[model samples]
Target chain A: MKLLVVRHAIAADPVEGQRDSARPLTSAGKRKFEGVVRGLKRLDVKLDLLLHSPLLRAVETADLMNALVEGETRVTSLLARAPSKALIEALDEPSVALVGHEPYVSELVAWLVTGERQLARGFPFKKGGVAWLEGEPVPGQMTLASMLTPAQLRAIGRKK
Target chain B: MRPAHRELEPASDAVEVDCSAVRIALQEHVARARDAEDSRAVHGLRVACARLDVFLRLGRRRALRDDLRWLRRSASNLRDLDVLLESSAAGELDAQTVSSLSTERTAARAAFLEVLASERCEALLDALANVPSVSAQRARAPLERLAERVRRRGEQLLDAPAEFERHHALRRALRRLRYAREWLGMDCTAIRALQDSLGALNDALVRETWISRVERPASSALASATSDSSSLVQSLSAGALHAWRATRREILELPA
Candidate 1:
């Protein structure tokens, strides 16, 4: 199985929203996410499942990617928090893309591949950055396949 | 109640010791009961086990071993019946659908109550009530043993090879870690983060499994059936994984 973990793009500050969950993606976030979609295409990556948090920023991110990838997209309550047992139980896919908030996305990546609570070093996932893990989904066994930032994708695009 | 035990220090120590022992025993029973297949028995056992575990760790009261053991056994017995009924309800047979299952479930619960009310069980409960209290210091060995058993079982499950098995195992480990954190009066924030990653991995597994096993095959079959008439169906069927990935974006857009 291949797991694509994406942190949601930059979002509006929670000040004007009733809750942080309601905050929408920033313009920069939208642009960055579009860049991410373009990058995935350039990389020739295909997804089987696209999952996102219920948050507006995550939903928008998933929407943009769904437009690009040919797969199923689902919004799940499990992605809403950093420590979601329900989300873990809900996994039954082979190639999945998850878009959610930080501390959670980073922490989840660390936990799945290491069975430890620390974040992976040097993996500074910016808005619209994508990290990929390939291999079996056993805890502490998945290998980091690749990670691409919007900047990297743009650079590659420029080269092509 | 009439005459107070004048030595506060001894009483305090006694309470601490008993509480520790009960807590250990309670957790042990809870783990065992979860493995049981009966829902009612499992529920009762889990509840009592949790109560005793919490009581010892949080309530700081020591109850007799006989009392704890009786609770465990009774809970286990109830759980067995519960599991049988639940499993029966979950069977693929036509009679096991939700509505039919409810009736069987109700009968199972009543039968369990009747079993509990029998003479032999009541006698066992009476014997349980007569257990003598021990010093707090006497509980160390049993507590350590129970903790070791839990740790070993948890490790084994977490180390399973299959993705589905590993997912469940990791979840169990997370739960145990959470329980341990609560018991030790520690923060659970880090453990919670680990759980989230595990969740994401599991989600990926599901999508991957569905595409490979179901959607892709079904799409291919449909494409083959229509291939003679149209080229579009063949093209549509060729990239099942890609198509599934595309649909995922829509699915993820739904309200969580």
Candidate 2:
């Protein structure tokens, strides 16, 4: 199975009396991620399934990617925060895409690549960054095939 | 050792890590490294150097390896200095040692800049920019070949006991195999674990060598550092060898 993990695009910083999970993607985030989706299309990215955290920004990001690629978007609680084995268990498709938040997104990438959660330290993902891994969901089984920052994706879109 | 995916790629348009893309990222990292005005920059530069080294070797682009080697050599001291200073700032190192290392680090930083500013370094960057698109064969042929190479190298490490160079050779071989597997997005945990352990052991050895190169500020401290580091290296090395043997045996036991 091939897994494409992405961090939700830019969102408004939390303020007093705001629920962190309620924050939505900024307008700029939407536009930039749209361009990124276009670029991924140029690269022939096709997702059989798209999954996202229950948070607003992540759900929106997943919906956007699903609009560009042929996939069914499903909101799951497993991707809300730090990833657990339950996150992998939720995957049933041959090719999958995940949209979530920082630290969690990068953490998942590191886990997929190294299989040790502790090694996930320092693998930070920029807002809207994406990583691709090839392997089963099994621990220590996945390989990181590619990783692209949001800027790189935008540039690829421009080039194409 | 267990082939995670029996079929590598059936799609006619399967796009792997293209050489052009890799080159572009490599160039960006080199530029970022050059603009490295802080610790993060230095860390990024060091990582880029390591990745470029592995990519160059795996692709069999021997021509560009020397340039990368020079870059890595020049940056090594700077990286260590950054780590030590970071630790010092966090109150991990004593004031005297921090003072001593800070002075040496400044000089090392200057030396690294001199190396980076050389015409040869610019030429190397230019060469990397023009690295031809990695061939499909270059990307795919290693899948099967890497498994065999890992098995062979692991066995060799087991056969040649107590030789520093032999252990180093095994480390390099495991790294090459891991890089290759990483490119293919295959399960590389077994090899990666071995490589990381070897890397830690190698780091301990490097620290010992660096201590010998510098004037001993405190003889007792120097002796203590070397003794602790050497023992750590020995234990790590033994553990790595044991792991490699187990990995090799697992691979051998798998039915074709």
Candidate 3:
């Protein structure tokens, strides 16, 4: 099974009195991430389902990925919290793309690979970056197949 | 605007908490419990809810904490009072003490009935009816930790048989271990004796508390309930202490 963990792309600066969850992906963030999605398509990456946080930014990111990759997109509160066993258990699909916020996305990847949710020591999953994982969705039990930066993913998308 | 009832499903790997057996049991019990005076129905409801709680906790799925907790609390007080009422009848209490308990039981039934008829209770039942997708994998981490926990509680009780708090704590922990094993379709006979002992001991403890709080006419059923409950407390405690040691030994002997 392939687990694709993604950090939400760049978002507009917060406006006064705006809930963090309500923040939207910036126009540039959407345009750039489209290339990343196309890169996923270029590699023939497909999803059984795309899961995203209920927040606006993650939702928008998920929508973009779903457009390119053509999978069912569903909002899951599991991605809204710290990476938990519940989130891992929910990844039953053969391929799932989870769009979530920063450290949480990184921590889920680390937890999957190392059984420990250590953030500072592992691959710094930059905005729109992704790590493809393989194995049972158990903590410290998965093999990291690849970790791709947004630029790398986009370049893969741009290849003739 | 968003859909009127938009809610995302649980994570992809996990199935929802609606086991068919449990759901049927809950719906059947809920129907019977609506009568307000049916103690058997209330008892059935509590047992069903407890089974669901064990499954959810052991499965480590964070789906229904608040609703389950509410349902448990709703069923328990009325359940406790009903037990005391039954004990009162069997103990041959005087007419006045029985009347007092009956009055209290009546009020409890009314309150419980009101809760059962609430929108929240309806939601819980609706939630329970959700069918689960089959997934074959046992979550071993929580079970391993719980096994360690039950063993620790057993040891604490073994070390000090007279500790009131330890008896209560072990009683609670043992129930979790038993139901959790049953949920996973694993054998639970290993801890049944300890569970029975703890069950009797806790019943005595609860009966004693109720007897103290209620009216006790001399030579009446309430007094007899008191004496019956009191006489068994020491023996039940001793029996549980032995069972604790036995169960703890059994747990330790299993391949860790």
Candidate 4:
């Protein structure tokens, strides 16, 4: 099983009239994240499941991701600040791609890889970054196959 | 405005496809890491380079080993500088020392870019796009070879002297072994923990060396600063030593 976790792309700053969850991905964010999907497609990553937090930006990111890979994209409240238990429960798939927020996404990666509740020091999950874990979906059963920054994805995507 | 997403076509079924992809990843990561100079990028570049090195070495392509070595060397001083600067920013080192280190980092960055542009590096990157006839049977050879090499290195580290240089070498060994285990998709938490301890020890030793080499002021403030820094380094080194010993023992006692 492979779990590909992605943080939501660059989002609009909090507006006076809008909630944080409603902030949409900025134009630049959409363009950069498209490159990420392109990179994944180039790698022949076939997602068996695609999930996203119910937040607008996460759903939008998942929708973009859905067009690149073969999978059903569905909104799930479980991915929004999901607890470790809920995160583990969501991992029951041959290959899953989860689009979510920062700190939480990085924390989830740490928990999945090291079985530690907190992220190992200095491990950052930048916006639009993606981490690939290969192993069983259970806690600590996975090994981080790869992690890529958005810049890296753009570079790879630009190659022939 | 957003551009249309690039359509992803199906990749070739060749086994080399995976290797080629990994190569692209290595190149992309190393290039991106060069500009960041952060701890995470430095670590990522090292791991990416290691993965490619293991894969290439397994394929008996020694030609690129020199290029990989150069890449690692280019990143080494910068990494250590970053570690030192992190603590220096907290007022451990004087402004003069911090400025000197930052200036050195700029030179290091330039040198790294020069190497990245070298013909050898360009050729290496170009060659990585092609993995000749990596069959299913041959695929397992690298993992087995890496595992054996890691085991041998572990034994060497256990018997090696406890000198600073030896421990540094051990740190490298642990990193290689851990990266190989990761390449093989094996659980590497224990090895990673040990590597972390070894890294901390290395950082402390680097700090001590830097302080000892750099000239300090002849004032009471300098005395107080030196005392504080020395104790911090001593404690850090000791804790790391203890962790290394404990982890090593656990490794040795594991089922063979």
Report the number of the highest-lDDT candidate.
Answer: 3
Candidate number of the best TM-score: 3
The candidate, 2 or 4, that scores higher on TM-score is 2
Candidate 3: residue B150 lDDT (0-100):
81
Model 2 docking grade: incorrect
Where does model 4 sit among the CAPRI classes? incorrect
On DockQ, the stronger of 2 and 3 is 3
Candidate 1: segments with Cα more than 4 A from true spot: A120-122, B1-256
How far residue A44's Cα lies from its native spot in candidate 1, in Å, is 1.4
Off by over 4 Å in 4: A1-160, B1-17, B20-22, B33-43, B132-161, B214-245, B248-256
Compose the digit string of candidate 3's lDDT tens values, residues B25-121. Answer: 7778888889545788788778777777666565554334345667777877678878876765453656676777778777877888887787557
Which wins on DockQ, candidate 3 or candidate 4?
3
Candidate 4, residue B193: the lDDT equals: 77
TM-score of chain A of 2: 0.93
Give the clashing pairs for model 2. none
* Per-residue lDDT of candidate 2, residues B1-256 (tens digit): 1112224452222533434444455456556656665666666555555566556544554434545667767878888777645643354334566667778888888897787666556545554553433333565554456567766766777787677666777787776666555555556676677777777777666666655565536656556656777888889889877776667645333653
Model 4 vs. true fold: TM: 0.49
Residue-level lDDT of model 2, residues A1-160, one tens digit each, is 9888998988878879867776767899889998888778777789887776656677567656864546455555567668888788877888898888777887788777787777766577888888878988887788888888888888888883
**What is model 2's DockQ versus the real complex?**
0.01
Worst 10 residues of 3 chain A by lDDT: A66-75
- The global C-alpha lDDT for each of the candidates, from Candidate 1 onward, is 0.51, 0.67, 0.72, 0.66
Model 4, range A51-70, lDDT digits (tens) per residue? 66756677567756865556
Clashes of each: 50, 0, 12, 0
Most accurate candidate by DockQ: 3
DockQ of 3: 0.02
Chain B TM (all candidates): 0.38, 0.75, 0.83, 0.74
